[model samples]
Target: MPAVLVLLLLSGFLSRAEAATVVARVDLSSQRMTVSVNGVPRYSWLVSTARRGYVTPTGVYRPQRLYRMYYSRKYYNSPMPYSIFYSGGYAIHGSYAVSQLGGPASHGCIRLHPSNAATLYSLVQSYGRGNTAIVITR
Candidate 1:
């Protein structure tokens, strides 16, 4: 009976976690990205943005397209799978390293941890493709 109760509880917790609606908000000054679900913060990660002169634009945008396998041979040697491009030449995509975050590191797109990016991608894909809006703030 105890084992059964524990299993039930665990299942419930997992389900809740999976059903979370993550909203990613980026702060350029602090180089931080806050992920909130239903108004509650689920996780926070350091992020990098465009250089001092080229800053990430602040506005409301939605995920207009999703690419599972993207390769930019001219710019990058690596392939960016599971990329969600929200703006022109800007996207939230998976990175090979978590260390590259938290500074002026990207051209103009928001870079995310591979796991976090994948999770966010799946969530957006599952919820509703055109409905998810990402609000990038200064």
Candidate 2:
């Protein structure tokens, strides 16, 4: 009975690990984001990264924090909804500037349409940070 219980626990753990795998890949050159779950592409959305004078760091990262709504302290209290902060102050968040998506316009963060941001926020929350990855590339 103990062995059977152990097997059940292990199977549950393995299933969660497999089901929770989430990846958000950002392409800087094209200003697009692709979201995948368990190795299957699920969403492709436009994104806005750093403007002419700013830079969006490129690398792989795990989400550091999640916020339903956040105000940027460095950028004049701009509203950042459904924020998934991956780096120090850099995040993937909802922006009101929908027209600026698919182009470079932010100070240095990745911006997405409000609904897309909410979707991503929900995915990351459901999966947990350890099971999610954020990859930014040129």
Candidate 3:
């Protein structure tokens, strides 16, 4: 009876861990970002990806690093609030240029509104690095 109870408890915990996965998809064609939890859309927002001259790599990746406050040393020391680095130096972060959203504007990173970025940062933090996936698509 004790062994059975322990197995059941472990099973429940495993299922919950699987269900907590969060997917963040960035569509370059539409310049939008959508976050879904367990296949249900939870958040959506406009974003600015790499401009025409620059390239934002498109592929499935996991969050490599997260920072509540980050400054880009390569980009004129710009503030990248709520930086979620997925690929190399590129990241999904908040931008001060709210008007440049909804189109390609950034050097290479995906840019979001300050508030929206903060919210996304919170969600990713809660779900944890092991449970979050970043999918960049055209």
Question: Best candidate, lDDT-wise?
Answer: 2
| Winner by lDDT between candidate 3 and candidate 2 | 2
* Highest TM-score against the true fold, candidate: 2
Which of 1 and 2 is ahead in lDDT? 2
Rank the models by lDDT, top first.
2, 3, 1
User: How does model 1 fare in lDDT?
Assistant: 0.67
Please provide, for model 1 over 10-129, each residue's C-alpha lDDT reduced to its tens digit, 9 standing for 90 to 100.
Answer: 656324333334456678888887766555666787766786566688765667889876765546666666788878778788777578787778767777777777877887888655
Worst 10 residues of 3 by lDDT: 1-10
Q: On a 0 to 100 scale, what is the lDDT of residue 133 in model 1?
A: 49
In TM-score terms, candidate 3 sits at 0.85
After superposition, the stretches of candidate 3 with alpha carbons farther than 4 Å from their true spots are: 1-20
Error of 3 at 44 (Å): 1.4
Q: Give lDDT tens digits, candidate 2, residues 58-112.
A: 8777899999999999989999999999999999999999999999999999999
Model 2 per-residue lDDT at 13: 34
In order of listing, the candidates' clash counts read 1, 0, 0
List runs of model 1 lying over 4 Å from the truth. Answer: 1-22
Q: Tell me how far the alpha carbon of residue 112 in candidate 1 is from the true structure, in angstroms, after superposition.
A: 1.0
Please say which candidate is ahead in TM-score: 1 or 2.
2
Runs in model 2 deviating more than 4 A are 1-20
Best-to-worst order by TM-score is 2, 3, 1
